[model samples]
Target: MTLNLPQLRAFLAVVDAGGFSAAAAELGMSQSAVSHAVASLERELAAPLLIRAHPVRTTALGERVLPHARMALSAVRSVEQIAADATGTMTGTVRLAATPTVCQGLVPGLLRHWREDQPRITVRVFEGDSGEVAAWLEDGTADAAVLIDPPPAAARAFPHADPGIQLATDEYRALLPRDHPLADEPGVDLRDLEDDPLLISPNGCEDRVRTLHRRAGLRFAPTHRVRDLATLIRMVQAGIGVTVLSEVSRSLIPADLVLLPLKPQTSRRLVLTGPQTRPWHPALRTLAESAAGHLAPTTARPAEGRPLPSGTR
Candidate 1:
């Protein structure tokens, strides 16, 4: 069973606080946000983690699991301790696989900060498409990776609790040739490009891209299908096609292409995933937390879009 540390924390908090409202008060979040966090965790776990009494209680499964969850969370906390300058150093390499786009954006900034703080730690990066990123983790080729958050379909197949398939809470914009007709449009709908080619990562991670098109009633047939962001952006710059991208993807977009906001907004997950069964390592956990820090507030993008449209069918 996958115990998502954050979700498990929320579940434990609700249990300790006696309900969502109390948990929210203690956590400094709105009650609705607390409930949503718990529900999101339940979605990933695929089992109930709590029972609602006058004061909520852990289900037998939750009860059996809480102690371990507490232990795991505590361990996770200890691992992140090294990330704090006062906590001392973490030495060794952390092999990471990340999309070509995230590698270019988030990693660079984080590395600068990391190197200054922890001079001896080494980081080796493997760049690949989302599917390949996931493959490296599945095969133990890398310690961890950041891939697009799993879509519901992919999540159903993998069915392990982790970061749930959720859109990045960020806006997505369409990249088009500078002079393309849609450049002037403040927001373009997916159906508007029915006959045009679409470029993006192929295979399972294309879920967010395809779901956006299908929801917008757009039929995105790729004229030149490619997986790498650098290549995709080059093609779009060449006026070959348009592509959907997260804000982070813009880091790779060329000067020649224009970015347009998508009307029924869409975003993709830059999820951090690794083998759940592998024993947690200090080096690995520090890497995970460090990786998480790259997306930290100093690195966080502003929320800039409405939810994607319904009717993916």
Candidate 2:
């Protein structure tokens, strides 16, 4: 006896979609063709696999065979993914997740580069907090994710193809209104803000901010709790309260706000994370390399009177 993948797929699709017509639409096949495929599958197995009802259901034997069929299909797809990786062809959709800051600061450049390099590949991005990003990856909702200050155990749990590909290490900076008394000063310590009414965004960075405060033996009781990044910046612009954010986030600050480096020099590393066990797509690997390039240090230029390095351009 011979088992056909198409027939099995058709059977599964019908069961999944709950009707032959819906499965036909999903598979881009005529209803008659899908019905025929299921019929052929039944003939091969010499038993009825599905009950032809409004919402189709599997028979006892079909339920017994379903697991093996799904496994076979998954194995076949894995083999195909391996082949695609070996050939270095960037095709298919890549589901990606990242925090709003990274999406605003870095992903646009990566998208532009990807468009020019591999137009065949489509990227779908989802914005979420670091914890949500991890949830997306664990639930298979995203092929990969960009995380800020990911816990050490998470790295061990979901190791990527390029484990140490650091996208960026952004230093935390103090955002103060230009009219503030200490705005003109170079830097300020976290302890100095104890008396001031602080404004902190309740987005993904809340935990990180709390941790930083906790380390300083302080607590964060924001005078105003802001949820949106843009709104928070506008509030700071209006001199509502001071806030702290990463260096990359400075781009969002208006001219009236001054960005000062934190006195203690706190920073967080953003890393690209991928599935630990699944075979990663070549496009994802390529993306990882591109992301790492963003943080690659540039060579210092030679002084006008000094000798140039051999490979200096």
Candidate 3:
């Protein structure tokens, strides 16, 4: 049986975008067209691939086919990139995933640089929680990602995959209500806020925050666990409780909230990485290399807290 590119792409798009309508929007196709493509693909394969529901899900067969579908699409992209490279004009879309903090604090500058340097290559950004971002990269939903202190095992999973490039090293800071007693202090220790309810966002920084408490010999108890950074900030503004967040998240903090250095400071490395389970796109490789040179000396900061060793992941 003969398979087609559009049919495969539609299948992958629906899976990645989570629904036919959303997939159509992403593919710039009519909903009927996207639905038809997937249906046609299923007919060719003689099995149903998706379980149609709100935020559609893949059937067991579809799950088994997903990796092959991604690889097939990636192979096509590689061929196209090869032709473009031979012409000395590289052009391709790179789906880049990042946590909300990186999206707000770091991505704009990187986009600006890419726009100027690699005008033909399109870079699309996807913002999610840290776990979601990593998952996207691993699953091929994103071509590249800005990862937060990715573990060593993630890199080891794909020996030939592009190693992560450090984008920035940002210290974690204590966020407090403006009128709080310790808000005026130059720095605040986790112990200093022990009596106050500790607010923490479980999006990406929860483990590091837990590590901080452990190092300080304090319990890892938190008063409220927030998932969204915006909601967390609003909670802090309304005097719900103080929280710890990356220094890069300062832009999201309002004037009424104060961000002070965390005593015995800790920092996490924000690294740009390609897919661990697939070949890197040519444009993605170029972007990764460019980022390493562009951000290295400039964004690197001395962390008073124990920093993860270089090339840790």
Kindly report which residue pairs in candidate 1 clash with one another. 149-269
83-120: candidate 1 lDDT, tens digit per residue: 64355666665567777777887667667866766566
Model 2 CA lDDT for position 114: 72
Across 1-313, the per-residue lDDT of candidate 3 in tens digits comes to 7799999999999999999999998889999999999999999999999999999999999999999999998899888767866786777789999988889888998999989888888899999888789888988999999888777775566545556566788899999999999989988888999988888887668888998998999999999998878888999998888999888888778999999999758998887777767777767866765665566666632222223223221
Residue runs of model 2 more than 4 Å from their true location after superposition: 1-78, 85-88, 155-164, 217-219, 294-313
The global Cα lDDT (0 to 1) of model 2 is 0.72
Candidate closest to the true structure, highest lDDT: 3
TM-score of each: 0.58, 0.68, 0.85
Checking candidate 3 for backbone clashes, the offending pairs are none
Winner on lDDT between 1 and 2 is 2
Q: Using alpha carbons, what is the TM-score of model 3?
A: 0.85
Candidate achieving the largest TM-score: 3
Return the clash pairs for model 2, or none. Answer: none
User: What would you estimate as the lDDT of candidate 3?
Assistant: 0.83
Model 3 off-target regions past 4 Å? 296-313
**Candidate achieving higher lDDT, 2 or 3:** 3
What TM-score does model 1 achieve against the real structure? Answer: 0.58
